[model samples]
Target: MSENLGTMTDFSPDDSVMLKDVLRGLALPQKNIPSLYFYDQRGSELFDAITELPEYYPTRTEIGILERHGAEMAAALGPGVRLIELGSGSALKTELLLGRLEDPAAYVPVEISREHLLAAAARIAADFPDLEVMPVTADFTEPFDLPEPARRRVERNVAFFPGSTIGNFPRGMAADLLAATCREVGAGGAMLIGVDLVKDRATLERAYNDAAGVTAQFNLNLLVRLNRELGADFDVAAFRHQAVWDEDAARIEMRLVSTRAQRVQVAGRPFEFAAGEVLVTEYSHKYTPAVFRSLAEGAGFRVARTWTDPEGLFSVQLLEVPGAAQDSSGGT
Candidate 1:
């Protein structure tokens, strides 16, 4: 392993912002919480565990596609390109791409977890001795500054956003995120994103509501996080995890349903919950090929190419600036 030290910054979750969002969301008519809050250090670890579950097909399917075609994706990107990944959790799958890219300028990973970001960056630095590992910790949803080191060494930047995380955003927010990413990488830069394809409702439901109850534990961990961080009094045992496929919304909605009528206090604010009342935890939208392509075009990116497993349960799409060279690799 190389002793190269990668630079890392701490732009973690803002305490005040989190408090405001939590209170505001709890006050809503439907009572919801932003999925972003699900990623404190513990939540991040639980998510990592969720990715490895046998029922969680997105992670494995995306990795399989990349394992088979990461080289082709890098080839389409050409040489001397800076690779920046958004919400780069663990960055485990990225090694496949980094191994194939020819003379890449740098590897900039943008993440929200400071600890996780630093650890992943250090591992990447050791693994790729010659590659510049500049890890940034920031909420990728917002516009943030990149360190001088990144701006100085980057050439043509390629933003890699895998893991079907885009599904977390609704149509409008997803568009805004893509626009922000476009600005980060500049007009002539490119993007490679993983999207979960609209599949059978049973499959989608099973993926979120796993049999081992690990998913349930992961969902409940949010309460544990709130109790510790925000001084919230949540009876973890009083709530149960529920994942349902919303056909009308074309998304999987995860909620923590109150087992009984109860009152909870968070940071001195009291809230009442009725029996069976639920707090909306997450929304993961599935998309068809046409829908995703349209979204990319609207966000100012052209679909350069797409790769998918034989079953088409997921898709890894290479999107580029309009004038960028089209990759003859097409689809697989």
Candidate 2:
């Protein structure tokens, strides 16, 4: 890690709280856990691996769009803008935009895993020596403060939430997060986000269930995480990973199915799992351009422009805050 990095937080995660979350999820009628817990240092590495798998099209597709239109996107946002990225894992795709940003004043990456966040921030600071690299260790779903320098050094801000992360949230929660981001970016600012477009079930399911089993590992790693941090006695081999498309919801759901009836103990409490039971781990909702635009508009932003690959597998949209000045065409 680079000590010269602009600012890296020293936020220690609360293990007791994590234990509580795990036990509570296990006790629920339909057991489920927050996806945020899946990013311990090891889990983070597994996720990075998942992104590289050939079956994972979102990462590559989003990167392709950024590489092709980075200059245009940067120019549209204008010069000296403070850039805040939510759930900025690895921040690999961000470098493409950083190169095109016209003297951007600061780069704030908000992430949940402290170790991963700091490591990424260090690398970014080293790569972009002149740009401020501030990493905030917090759940992006909740409100968190940005580094004071990032706010003080620039007048206009743009929250860059790439990777189709907003899809992980339910529709209502997604809107709330977008609205919160609008408040954080404030007036005269904007947001650049990625969204996975609705696609065929076979393709969507395949993406989440790669032949290499990396996605399954990524999902099961949650159990390993619970075992390690929450004292949960979960037999990793007793459950199997599954990914299915919910057509009506236009989403992909990741779950771990129990192979047989089982009982687990976490935080000194026993939890029962019936045969064939499933623990819902994650949901990735796909959206059409119109649906996404409605979401942005509902959150007090105007969809300035949207870019996608020819296949339309993913979308990157630039949303301007209500009062932000824009090109006559409405968006840049």
Instruction: Score residue 229 of candidate 2 by CA lDDT.
Output: 79
Instruction: List per-candidate RMSD values in Å.
Output: 4.1, 3.8
Model 2, residue 290: displacement in angstroms? 1.0
- Per-residue alpha-carbon lDDT of model 1 for 104-168, expressed as tens digits? 87787888878787878888998888787878888888766665433234457788999999999
Candidate 1 clashing pairs, residues 3+ apart or interchain: none
How accurate locally, in lDDT, is each candidate?
0.84, 0.85
In candidate 2, stretches whose alpha carbon ends up further than 4 angstroms from where it belongs are 1-4, 11-13, 150-152, 324-332
The Cα RMSD in angstroms, rounded to one decimal, for candidate 2 relative to the true structure is 3.8
Name the lDDT of candidate 2: 0.85
Candidate 2 per-residue lDDT over residues 1-332, each given as its tens digit: 45447656544458877777777877889899988898988889999999999888999999999999999999989887778888889999999999999888788888888878888888898998878787788777765566655323575788899999999998999999888887778777899999999999888998999999998888889999888877789999999999999999989989999999999888789888899999999989999999989998999999999999989999999998877533211111
CA lDDT of 221 in candidate 2? 90
Alpha-carbon shift of residue 263 in model 2 (angstroms): 0.7
